[model samples]
Target: MQDKKLSELAATIADPARHDPGDAPISISAGLADWMLAQKLSLAFTSYQTGQLIVAGVGPDLRLSFNQQQYARATGLCYDRGRLIVASMFQIWRLENMLRPGHYANNAFDMALVPRTAHTVGYLDTHELSVDTAGQIIFVNSRYSCLATIDDVHSFRPVWQPKFISALAPEDRCHLNGLAMDGGRPRFVTLAGISDEKDGWRAIRQRGGAVIDVASDEVVVSGLTMPHSPRVHDGALWLLDSGRGQIVRVDPANGKQDDVAFCPGFLRGLAFHGNWAIVTVSLAREDKFRELAIQEGLEERGLAAKCGVLIIDTRTGNVDHSILLGGKFTEMFDVALLPGVRNPMTIGPATVDMIGAVTIGNPAP
Candidate 1:
C-alpha cells in the first residue's frame, strides 16, 4: 500500500559475526585443481508444482503468469533485444507459450533443448548470465570453479576462460555465485560454507555472505548472512542479503552501505526497473542454518522468517509497489521484465548474438 518508514525499521547489526572477518589468510589445498572441476550440483529454478504456471512478482496487483513446462527453475533474468531471456539454474530456455498478450494460463511443462557445449563438454550448470562487449554471454558455472563465456547460443562453447581466483593457489576453490558486471567488466561475489584455500586453512569468514569483483579479483564486500544474488542499481551496487532478509546498496567509490529494503523470509533474487528495485522473496527455513548456528553459536540470535518479492523505490525510499505470491506454491529463482518482443519465445542464435558481442554489457547502472 505504502512504503515502510525507515524510522520504523531498526538499522542495527545484531550479529557481530556478520559484521567483519578481518583479513585472515587461508591455506591453499593440494587438491584445489580437482575440487574446482568437481563443483557441479543439481540446480533447478523450481517453477512448478501442479499447474504449469511459474508465478512472478511484477507489481502490487500484477503477477506474471508464465508457462513452467517451457522452462526449468530460472535463477537469473536479462533482456536481449526486448525479449525475456532467463537463466534457468542449470540451462537456458526461451518461453514460447507463456509470452503472450494478456493471457493468464495456469498450465504446466513444455519441451526444452539443452544448448550443445564445446567439444561435447557437459554444460557446467550456471546461475546468472551477463552479456559482454561483442555479445558474448558471461555465465557462472557453479559446478566448475571458474567463469566462462559462450560466443553463440546454438553452439554452447566458451570462447574466453578467465583465470579463476582459486587457480592462484596450489589448490584453490571458491563457490562463485551472484555475478554482476561492473562498468562493463566481469565482477563477482562468492558464497561458501567452507574455505577456498587448499592448504587445509578453512577460514570460516562468512557470517552471512560475501561478493567479489572478478576483473579486479578482490573481495569488495564481506560479513553478510547468506547474500546470494547482487546487482548494481542507480549507479550503486545493490545486493540481496538472504540471511538478513534485506537489500543493501553499497557505493564503490567510498564503501558506503545503505539499507534500502527488507524481506523477512527467503529473499534471494534481485533486479531493477527504472527507479524501482525488485527482490524475490521466500519464507525462511531455520532448519537450514542448523550447522552454522551450532558452529559459531552466537548469543544474539537472528529470527527465521517467510518469503516473497519486496519492491522498493530507490528515489523516495518507498515501496510504492509489490507482488506477494503464496509461499506454498510459489518459489521464484529470478525476475526479469520483458521489453519489446512479446512472449511465445524461441532462441536459436541472436543476429547480434549476445554470446560473442563484446559491446553488450550488464543490466546494472
Candidate 2:
C-alpha cells in the first residue's frame, strides 16, 4: 500500500542516468573524499537500538567510532568554541573535546526563567542549534512557541524568549523547526512550519510557513507549505521547503524564494561541504516513517531507501553523491559533516532541543 506507492515514486524519482562527476574509485584519489576521511569523527551509538550519535569515515566500508553514553536521540548538533553541542528536547548535551568515556555532569544549569513552571525551558521537539561568535546557542522547536537560548550551556540563563501573543491565547503548538545565522549575528533566523503567532497553531489565514528574521520578529516569506532545515551556503540563505518538495534559496534583501532542487517525499537535515549539501530524506509519506514499509512492492523486500545523505551542487541543482540508509530507520532529523570524519554524520529518528529567539544585536524598530 503505502510502501508500494513509495517505491513507485522512487522508481520515477531515481535517475540512474545521473552519475557521480568523478567516478574516482571509492578508495582512490585525494579530493573531497580524502579530506572527509582524513578528518572524520565517529559520533556513533553504543547500542544500535539507542545509539546517541555515530561517527564514520568515508568509503563504502564506513568505519565507525564512538564516545560512549547515549545522548538520547540527539536532533541537532553545532560546533561551538571547539566542542560539539548536541541538541535534544529532554536535554542539551555538550561533548567537549576533552570529554572522557564515562564522565557525566548533571544540572548543566537551572533557572527560574521557563514560564510553564512545569518543565525545564527545554524543547518539546528541538530540531536545530546555531551558535554565535559570542558562544551563545540559538535553538528552535517543532511545537513550542518560543525560540529559546542558553547564554551559557552550563547555566540556565534565558537571553531571548519568544514573545507570546496574549490576545490570541495560543496553544503553544506553532513549531519552530530550523535556524540559520545571518551575517554571523544570531538575530536573524529562518523558520519552517511556523504556527500562528496568535494561537500557536497554523494560522490558515497567514501564509503556510516562512523564513523569519527573528530580530524583527517578522516573517521573511509567507505562504510556504512546510519548510524545514535551513543554512547559509555560498553567501546565500539556502532553505528546504519540504512541503513543495523543493530546495529553495531566499534573498536576504527581499525574502523572495526560488527553487533550487526538488525531491519527492519529505526531505530534512541539511549541511554543506564546500558547495555540496549533505541532505537526509525520509521516504515515509504520511508523518510516520513506518508508512514507507507499506507503500506497495516495498512491503516484501522492505526499502533500504536511497534517502540518506545527498551531496547536492547548489549552483546546478545536481546531486553529486548520495549516501543511502537502511529503511529500518525511520527519519533523520539533522545531518552534519563529521568534524573529523570525511563522509558526513546524520543524527537519526526525529529529535528536539531547546531554542532561543534570534538575538538581533541591533534590530530596526
Candidate 3:
C-alpha cells in the first residue's frame, strides 16, 4: 500500500536519532528523497507552535538530513541567493550560508547557514518576506496591516497598505499576511478581510478574504475563504484558500479563480520549485477560532488535518510528495526551498560553533 510504503520509508529516512526525543515524529513520502535529489532541492520551514526553524535536505547517501534551530515564534522564512531570512518573535534574522561551492562541513553538510545580523522589528507579528531587486527586505507586518521594511530607529517602515485601511495601527484590522513579488517588486497581497476597523477581520473571517494589487490599489479578487500565501508563479497568480483547504489560481482580470489542488490541513506557506509547488499545511487552531470549511472537507474525505510539507505539480494538480508531522509539532507557518543546497545546517545563537566560526563578507553565493 502507498501508505505503508511511505511509513516504511519514514522509518528509515527520518533519522530519528538526530531528532530530539521531545520533538514530533515525522513521516515522509517514500519517493520524496529521490524526487528532491533529482530536482536538487532542500526545504526550510518554521514551526510557530514549537518555536523552531528546521531545514530538511538530502545527503550523499540520499537520506534525509534534518537540522533545527530554536527561534521564538518562528514564522515566515525566505532563501534569497546565499542568504536565508527568517521572521521571529521580535527580530528578523539574516543568515548567510557559510560554505562555498565544493566545500563541506565535517565532510557532510554542503551548506551552513550562520546568523550574521538581525533587525529588531518589534512584536509586529511579521509574516511572509521577499527581497526586491534593490536588495531590500519587504515583509508583511500583520499587526499593522501593511507591508513594511526594516528601519534603523523605528520598529518598521510601512511601505504599502490596503486602500481600505485608513491608517497604520496595531489594531490588526485586515490581517495582511501574504506578499507576492513580481519582477522583483511586491505586486499583490492576501488578506483575511478588507475591514479598516480594529479586529474587523474577525467578523467575516470565512468568506471575506481577498487579494489586493499592490501597484493599482485594487481588490483584484474577492470572496475567498481565509486566503493566505498569494504567489506569482509562471505568469499566473496562485494562492491558498485556507478555510477551504485548497489551492486556487486567480485570473486577475475578472477575479475568476480556479481550483488547482486540495490538500489536507489549513494551507499557509507556498514556494515554487521549477514545476513543483511546495506548500506548508497545518492543523487548524482549536482555541479562538471558528470551524472552517476545511474541517468539513476533511471529514467528508475521512482524512485528518496534517501538519507538514506538501508538493504539488502545478501543471497537472498532482500531489507528488507529502511529509506529515505529529506529536509536539502540530503547526507550521511557512517554508523556503533552498535550490541546489544539500545537507544544509543552521547555527543558532546558543551554539558554540557559531561563536567560534568567523567570516567576513558573504557566506554562500
* Candidate that would win on TM-score: 3
lDDT of 3 by residue, 219-292 (tens): 88888878999998877899999989989988765667899888888899999988888998887777322368
**lDDT tens digits, residue span 88-168, model 1:** 423554333222344332221121212223221223445666666665667665545456665343425442223434342
Q: Tens digits of per-residue lDDT for model 2 on 1-365?
A: 14574454344325322221122211222243544555443222111112235444443454321122234445776654445666653556655432223332221211111111112334345567777776666666444445556633442343343443322222444556777776666554445445445334445312456666667777667666566777777767777766555688878777777888755445677777666666766565445434221233233445333344566777798766554444244355666554543332332222231233112334678
TM-score of each: 0.59, 0.63, 0.91
Pairs of residues at least 3 apart in sequence or in different chains that clash in candidate 3:
none
Of models 2 and 3, which has the larger lDDT?
3
Query: Candidate 1 overall Cα lDDT vs. reference?
Result: 0.46
Kindly report which residue stretches of model 1 are placed more than 4 angstroms away from their true locations once superposed.
1-67, 94-123, 151-173, 197-205, 289-304, 315-318, 327-330, 340-365
- Cα error, residue 247 of model 1, in Å, equals 0.6
Give the per-residue Cα lDDT of candidate 2 at 217: 73
